[model samples]
Target: MPVCPYCQVEMDDDLDTCPNCGITMIYFFKCQRCGQEFATTGILKFCPLCDADLSEQMN
Candidate 1:
């Protein structure tokens, strides 16, 4: 499960729109080294696949 960024509510991975906040979800994290995109809880500082520093790529 992933938490909705807007409403801070837990949601299913298959959902594109948040059920609690009605906001469209986007994979806000993108790795500059591997070009991988994912949604995170702000605890991850590196790309899971390439180990690239994702501290600055929060958009």
Candidate 2:
């Protein structure tokens, strides 16, 4: 479970937009294996760097 930084509302980890604030929540990610950083508009399933499955590794 993660909270929206802007509205402080509880939200699902896979959500890209805040239900309460109606704002798009872009996620910044870093690959665990390769240490590669990237940005996504929503939840991502894999790391662009090493093609690693990021469902479990991402926050």
Candidate 2 shows a clash count of 0
Q: How many residue pairs clash in each candidate?
A: 0, 0
- Per-residue C-alpha lDDT of model 1 across residues 1-59, encoded as one tens digit per residue: 87887889998766778898888775567788988878753346788999998778543
Off by over 4 Å in 1: 1-27
RMSD in Å for all candidates: 7.1, 2.0
- C-alpha lDDT score of every prediction, in listed order: 0.75, 0.84
Best by TM-score: 2
Segments in model 2 whose C-alpha atoms lie over 4 Å from true places: none
lDDT of 1 at 23: 87
